[model samples]
Target: MASKERKTPLIRVKNLYKVFGPNAGKVLQQVKEGKSKDDILAETGHTVGLSDINMDIYPGEIFVVMGLSGSGKSTLIRHFNRLIDPTAGVIEVEGSDVMSFDDKALQQFRRHKMSMVFQRFGLMPHRSVLDNIGYGLQIQGVAKQEREKLARYWLETVGLDGYDKHFPANLSGGQQQRVGLARALCTDADILLMDEAFSALDPLIRSEMQDQLIELQEKLHKTIVFITHDLDEALRLGDRIAILRDGVLVQQGEPVDILLHPADDYVEAFVKDVNRARALTVETVMKPQVCRISAETIGEALAEMRKSKDDYGYYINEDGYQGVITQETLEGVEQSEYDKAIDPSLLDSVPAVHTDALLEAVIPETLDSEHPLPVINADGDVEGRLSRSTLAEVLSDQAGSEEDDEKVKKLKTSKSLAA
Candidate 1:
């Protein structure tokens, strides 16, 4: 993981406020004094678009801004590039004041420092895929050959390699969005502002685009500001999430932090709908090792593990974790070899998870692993273990199901246990 302490803010907003009306300046004090949005609207005919929003966007992190309609999520992203000026507050990009930028400076900043991918797949209808992807570079006066080269590279990066000449009119929604992503990427901008970038596609395609974005972010590490109303999308993509409601900044934190501890009733209501097992870290339910086998020889460990009837067993050397041993491997060792020095190859490898990983990420690996999943920490040392019962109980509990016993009995086929 990147060390956050060493990173500086790429963008900073302090006491940001955006209100819409001729009397915005006059009504600002009322809103600041804790007047309700409706009362302010009734008295001054003004609508608050954002309220004292403050956050520091770190370098190379995906910062998600999410909210329902009229939450000012869209309005907030527009302030990043000064597309919508704030009613009152600071908007700084790269330590420079964005609100202070003149027309020319703002234009230059928009052209070179930032790029946006819209939910509507804003590709040029008449332009070919290659031309559309290179459109930003073209505007920057890049030569056609060089710009096309950059475009083609990002085209392949986004998995739209052979569809270079196809127009947006001919491509599917997903393909068009891919082109839009590539267009933003080709410019090599420092920050990407994506407003509901994948909300227009079908479920499967939307999921595919989300995965594609994750893979791209892993390789490129560009600082991204993603706007979405979907909690799932925000949890999936955001390194840190900021939720807005009625133009109020309700909460901001890491995904797991938000999921584990919501800031208020509004935030709690949002989390109640998420799949707890899918969003929670492995460490949430991981427990101490259930069965440990310590022996002077490999054969002794194997014999002890057989009594447990589990397919996998933990091997301890001097009462410390060595690795998980398999029942299948133990069956082949001859009695005479019991006294020999332990071989590293004798330890069986099974499915493992990091303590910080979401439980959903390890479920697939566990399907073929009848043994418990060992949870390791950042130092690659065994910290705890996750058993089938715990997983089933957590899942059933999250569902608020009364049939936990039935779920446990059926977990074998439902992928709670390893093979």
Candidate 2:
């Protein structure tokens, strides 16, 4: 994804630090003075849950906070809605300080502005799927008829229309999570906070739920704060990912950025086992080597290819890439009339892939053909070329070099220094 139009953050967490023990707030000074989570714990018996955590969650984006067990991923998410109060920090939603809200204001905020989906599905076993989905609306004191109608609409939205009367116990894990998701949506809140929402499902069911959230995001554009430990899940769902270790933010960035340029050894280790084939796209390794030949004749096309030092070139009109003219095609038309229009029949078939296509998908095409696969964008325009060599390099475990790591470290250092 190229740079999009900048939008102000819908939620901001500033200097957020959470300490979980009796004397939690008392350790603020030690925690802020560059003390490690373990050090703070050993000295004060207060476990550092989050340390100097800051984030600007933009609207209509899935911002993922992920870490291993006890990394405070869940702890950090809870502070967003004041489910757990920070030891010392600020949480703001739409310019309103979360900590400043009174009991009534907080209740109203939770009901109207945000909804949560939990790891356990958090459904009432006694209630029907329809009742479970509408539970948030029921809490809001909405009329029974209207809440049921809204719940039914979301029931169908999450692909569980006929099973409305069924209880949570009757459904599979995937279906139950869909009910949780539909429950969150029924509130019509601007923000959705999902804390390990799909972590309980089987591999296939997990993947299915991930796909569902992505599809729903495309249409609804809710400001989502998703928590997950699975790298694949985070990469697939998060617009941006923040990696945590022992409650400290190790790195935060786009999936490609994190994969190609990890911030630290901790982050590096976490991502080393990630499946790059599925994570990387053709655009990442593609070169801008499309030799455009606007020629009237085969001679002109041959001249263009010679000048570019390429064995083949594509005939491009305003419409887009037409066809390939290889050296073989040129030799066959060497004696043709120099001024005659190039015969389309003589052109060689060129393999092509979309820019967003994964490297794994394009690797087969590269293996099958000798020519570079033209990378086409959404507008049917040739953006670049994906060669076999480039694909090989990307697939290699050492896809990034030591020099690349250095550059990334310097970049992160500079950012930290500036901050």
Candidate 3:
């Protein structure tokens, strides 16, 4: 894992606000004075687009802003590239204060350093795909030949190699969005601002586009500010997610961390239905030094695992850890030839997860499957096994912890009432 100190933040937003009203200044004054939420809402009738927001976006990180329609996710994203100027507070991009830049400076900043992709595929109907992708480079006075070369490279990069001559109007919705992505990427800007960029596509195409974007980001390592209302998309794409509610930043962290330890009721509700186990892996939840096993007889394996009193057993291969066969699996199976005929490819099951996955993710896979799964490290060595009982223990602990917290809260409330 990379050390946090080694990663420099590429963008920073501090105490940002964007209230829209004639008396926005006075409204902000009231907000800063620590008025109650209802009082502030009643006084100016000013919608707080963003309130006292503070965050750091690391270089090469796909930082996602997620929320509902009026959550200020869009407004917050706009502030990064200066699409919408903040009413008060500071926004720094690449160590420069964006709010202080003059019109010419800001224009130059956007043209050279930043690019945006909108939910609607913004493309010219009459212009060819090449023209649209090359538009930014052309505006910056690059030679037509040079820009066209760059555009062609991006078109190919975005999987639209032969569609350069086609007009946007002729393209499908997904294809048009690809053109938009290519256009944003063609500028070779250091920062990419995507505002619900894949929302318009059908679910299948949207997933395809997400995969494409992940592949591209892995290769390019561009710093991206992605905005979306879809929690699943945010969780899937974001290295770190910032959840906004009524313009206030509710929570921010890696997806697993956020899901496992939501900071508020709102965030908990947002991720309540998410299949966390799939998102997490065995590596995150496995206990250390658990019993090890070989891909031999089930009776022998069950006896050894039971001796260790562990829920799961790790199967070792000539190379390293191969798979896991648990007691649950052994108990559930009836003596059959099919069990003996288990494919040798079973040894090649999906690689085990590191100890970093959230319980929400690790639990489901263990429960859903008939066999215990191996938890592997980055080097493909089997670290341990994660099984159904382990998952149950995690869920039970979570529930117990919540109950304890509630008791603590109630105790505090009662004490305060007596005082």
Scored by CA lDDT, what does every candidate get? Answer: 0.84, 0.84, 0.77
Clashing pairs in 1: 369-418, 370-418
Q: What are the runs in model 1 whose C-alpha is more than 4 Å off?
A: 1-6, 281-351, 354-358, 361-372, 377-384, 387-419
Q: Looking at model 2, how many pairs of residues clash? A: 0
Alpha-carbon shift of residue 43 in model 3 (angstroms): 2.8
- Per-residue alpha-carbon lDDT of candidate 3 for residues 192-263, written as tens digits (9 for 90 to 100): 999999999999999999999999998898989999999889878888899998888989987767877899
Q: What are the runs in model 2 whose C-alpha is more than 4 Å off? A: 1-5, 295-311, 326-336, 400-419
**Of the candidates shown, which would achieve the greatest TM-score relative to the real structure?**
2
Show how many residue pairs clash in every candidate, following the order shown: 2, 0, 12
Q: State the lDDT of candidate 2 residue by residue for 1-419, as single tens digits.
A: 22345588899989999888887767888888889888887888888888999889888889999999999999999999989998898899999999999999999999999999999999999999999999999999999999999999999999998999999999999999999999999999999999999999999999989989988988998989999999889888888999999988889988878888899998888888876768877777788866788787767877787788677876776667877778767766646466677777867677779988887666656655667878888898888998756655555555555234443333333322223
TM-score of 2: 0.88
